[model samples]
Target: MVLDTQIKAQLQQYLTMLEGDLVLKISAGEDKTSRDMVELVTELEKMSPRITVEHVQLERTPSFSVNKVGEDSGVVFAGLPLGHEFTSLVLALLQVSGRAPKVDEAVIKRIQAIQEPLHFETFVSLTCHNCPDVVQALNIMAVLNPNITHTMVEGGTFQDEVKAKDIMAVPTVFLNNENFAGGRMEIEDILQKLGSKSDGTEFANVEPFDVLVVGGGPAGASAAIYTARKGIRTGIVAERFGGQVNDTLSIENIIGTKVTEGPKFVASLEGHVADYDIEVMKSQRVAHISRKELVEVELENGAVLKSKAVILSTGARYRQLGVPGEEAFKNKGVAYCPHCDGPIFKGKNVAVVGGGNSGVEAAIDLAGIVNHVTLLQRGNELKADRVLQERLRSLPNVTVLTNALTQEITGTDKVNGLTYVDRVSGQEHHIELEGVFVQIGLLPNTEFLRGTIDVNAHGEIIVDKHGATSMPGVFAAGDCTDTVYKQIVISMGSGATAALGAFDYLIRHTAPTQELVGV
Candidate 1:
């Protein structure tokens, strides 16, 4: 059987939701991948009476298309859609079988309104937790709009294409055969990239909020929920809902839950937030914030929102090495998110830079996929926990270098090697490798607040015990603040503290009604 008992049982339950019959057109060859594809499709056909299969010639061998009865959905899977992509395949089957996708009505309208014919091909790895979002998003677009087509190309099953395209990252998307975007993107993100207008006027005319949270991560979600529970007008504007949490793979530190993945946890957060009467503005970036009669927060799309109080829970992002060729080689050979990009470098030599817990964990993870993992640390020793360090040391193919400072990431079209200097010996060294995974640390996403609020030397917003920042009516939390620990639980607690603090401020100091200030 292509699927295990548990998976097959689950599939059987979900297959019952299909509203109508669907067809799976298979294009196969006498290869292992093709044979697997045939077996999987045959098994799927047997599981549901609504599913039927037909052998046909397609553009790519060992591929299949999910289509409606007597109609084409333009959604194709170029490889075995197992692992993290299994959910994508299930969603495709249901959607193609006439079940409506759970998307915003406005987003569905935007997808159907596209005038241009766009063919989107997303390269993905089955093991990558982040690839399914992009794959499922494009598949939904294809299923909704006849003018759009999308194919999920598994990189492992198409090595030649991956090499030719120089795709060193998972979830790399191409629009019309041109490199479009990399990393995890939501449906709204894709629409915005296609030049969808946000209509800032809608935001400008909205009533002023009692509390506005400027992020959507764990911290921001906590703040929004805490404030909304108080029966106040709470609105959250986030560039993306999950923020750095989406890139995270396994989150075991969350209280009450033994373990959970990033996407799953984010889904719970979204569901919880949906139960409250909070306004959520997704895919919106805060450009500036100023305090007048009321604090005015300006969005990048020229939308200005006023609030009686603001909570800056904007979290931090992965810190770059700031070395030469890092930017140019990004998505080529240099990458972050080891869980997302590790499988792409299978059997290839790669290096992980950093010595802390994140770096050591990355090296340990990469050692299993890559041929070799050379961990370069700037400090004299690995700073990871004892268990992690011991696990990393047990990896035979992994090498640990202490007191090593990365100098540059060298590459032409793609990364070939990297240079580093031995901090103690003052000697430079180079390692030949195909890819580099950076897990140094994170920098706060508080650049938009510089000079307006009090930030420390590291650009972290300084907050008091109550999570109130130097600027009155403004609070900071999570990794963006000068918090000693950057744990998720800590961030959530700080978020609550900030929300309560903002509520106290709102009650004690009532703001005078005034005109909204323009950015």
Candidate 2:
């Protein structure tokens, strides 16, 4: 059997939910991957009475398509969908067998409304935690709309195709044989990219909020919940619902929970928020914020929102290398998330930049997958924990260089090498590599409030102990503020403090509004 006994048992339980008969139309060759694919499919067929296998020709060999008994579903997998993609494969089988996908009805309508034929292929690694979201979203679209077709192209099994397409990132999507997008994206994000209207009409005439949280990460979610508990009008606007937490892999620092992943934690947060009456506007960005009769917040979609108080919890994003070719080579040969993109560089030389915990951890992880890892640190010594540093040093394929400053990421179509300077010797050196993973740090997402708010040189909002900013009635919290420590629990605590601070400001400063006075 291609699957372990434990995995096969769990898969058997999920397969029992199949609503109708389905067939696995497989195209195979006399290769190892093909043999593995055949074994996996036949094993699955034996587990479910409703499933059967059919040998057939497909666009890609060592691939298979899950279809209803009579019609094609247009959802294909180009390799073994185990690891992080195993859930995606199971969902595909269930949905293709006439089971409804658990998505919003409005989103289903939008997917079905697309008239243009779109053939999407997403390249992914089995270890990528972020790739399944994009793959599942596109698969849902394929299952919902006959005009849309999607294929999960496993990069490890089809390295030649990945090289031909010059793909260095997981979940890199191509539409109609051309690059469409890269990185993790939800179904709504994909719809927006396809010109689906996300106009602000739905929010234009909405009632003003008592408190408006400007982000939807851990901080924003906490604040919104706190404010809504007070029976006041609460709203949250975010570029994406989960913010930086969505890209996180494993998080072990959360209190009460021994360990949890980022996406899983965000799901529970969303569920908790759903229990309240907060108005959530996701996939939207705040373009400007100003104080008038009320704090007027303008969204990039041309919608204006007014609130008695505003809490800034926009969170932070990955800091770029800022060196030459870094921006141009993004998704080409430069990447940020080692967990998401590491397997794509299997058996190739790569470099990890930075000396902190994230950098050292990335170097240690990549050393197991990539052929070699070169870790560059600008400081005289690594800033990681002694245990982590010892572990990273133990890796035979890892090379550590202290006092090294990156100069450029040299590449033509893809990353060919990187140039760095040895600060102690004032000497420059270049190394040929296939990829560069940057783990420097993060920059606060406070550009939109730069001129209006009191921000430090690093663009972090200045906040007091109560999370109150320089501007009265404006509160800031979480990593976007000048918080000494940036942790999920700390962000949640600050969020509560900010919400209570906003309520206090509303009671003292603003005249007694009906919502506040409970009149």
Candidate 3:
């Protein structure tokens, strides 16, 4: 069911009066005669006097209204709550249960004051691990402000839109008509532009910088370091200090550094950038960015920044299992990175889902450390590279289960087993395992960039050889761009390229009177 502002506020108030555990059930069925739905609600009511249940009918309700189905029911179902929409269901329940997720208060205030309805459409695929966080962040915004509707469209289902919009990745968030593109967003950043109370604020007196980078990932960091060293007044804004690299476990391929951990490498990079004169704003969320005489950036803290050039180094995220028990067992038995947690599952059986290179790699890695490895694939053929497929096939400890789709993860406190359906023979089976690593592949973090930059069919940013986007004064690099290879070293190299390009743009435009011809 679509929740409006009034109903959301009312539910929040209702939750504040109650105490104890709460459960909210959103049913897709319209008929009140469904026994399962009734039983579910009955169970919830029995849990605690504070318990509340909600049902949403897909067939017989308005597009965006909260309807009560039964006595004490919180909301009614109105549409399919799958993909990114499932986040909305969680938020609705959280609000009804009186536990608002921790969010920046200023961000919430800004979002609530919006006079226009803000639509955020994010395109994602089931295989992209990194896409979920972007979708979840938008869903949180929708929960706080009913005027904001967040739509999560599967990349395959919206092929036409993908082609038209030139999307090249998943988890791409589109705001109104502008594009925010990939990476996790800090709540404050979202509120600054959408919730702005100032109506007559003019851009007449705002000073501009030579370069402005939107992300603090490897690419953004590299760009900032290079540009700032070149004496450019570079300003780098990021939701967090490190981008996707912060979540990585190890880094073995970074040139110069023989072997390094993810956190350590990021720390070093941050240190290097700190040594320069660059204006680095950590934990700042960029709400809106526009290019006129200079690129304008509105921050969530109610501050505005201007720059002559912009670089988007926002990276991607990990994919998640939508099956039951997956979320419940996060960090318990379900993990996304093998390198991050493989040691914890030593001598224990583990299952690796997906047949791509990452899945095979994870399975092979786990096979070396774990007792056994179950490599489950939804398709009959292995989609990994030839070398990885060969290595995985050579491993006797790795059991390859082709044409298998994971239906559910079963466990009490941790993952004990997983149920899978065979697509070819229609047979269902369960395998016991201590951990399940989902290595489906990476999704480009580009949801916040809809209608703003030119992305590829895969939702990757479309950049020229010099890392420039379709929009002038804006550039992109690293994994976020539509580059053929996505490696840490390559992303760093691209960052350097983008920084140089941005530097050139600033020199040409900012110093138009100077005959700056040579390198």
The candidate scoring highest on TM-score is 1
User: What C-alpha lDDT do the candidate models reach, one value each?
Assistant: 0.92, 0.91, 0.69
- The number of clashing residue pairs in each candidate reads 0, 0, 40
The parts of candidate 1 lying over 4 Å away from their true place are 511-519
Kindly report the root-mean-square deviation of model 3 from the true structure over all alpha carbons: 15.4
- Please write out the lDDT profile of model 3 over residues 183-252, one tens digit for every residue: 3445554454444543223333545667888889889899998887777577788877677776665577
Cα error, candidate 2, residue 283 (Å): 1.4
Scored against the true structure, residue 33 in model 2 reaches a CA lDDT of 90
TM-score for each model: 0.95, 0.92, 0.57
lDDT of 2 by residue, 365-468 (tens): 99999999999999999999999999999989999999999999999989999999999999999999989999999999999997899999899999998899
lDDT of 1 by residue, 1-519 (tens): 678999999999999999999999999999999999999999899999989999999888889999988998999999999999999999999998888998877788889999899999999998888899999999999989999999999998999999999899989999999999999998989999899867675676689998999999999999999988887889999988878988888999998999999988888998999999899988888899999989999998898999999999999999999999899999999999999999899999999999899999999889988899999999898889999999999999999999999999999999999999999889999999999999999999999998899999999999999999887899988999999999999999999999999888987897423322220
Where in model 2 is the C-alpha error above 4 Å? 2-21, 30-32, 42-52, 97-109, 507-519
Candidate 2, lDDT over the whole model: 0.91
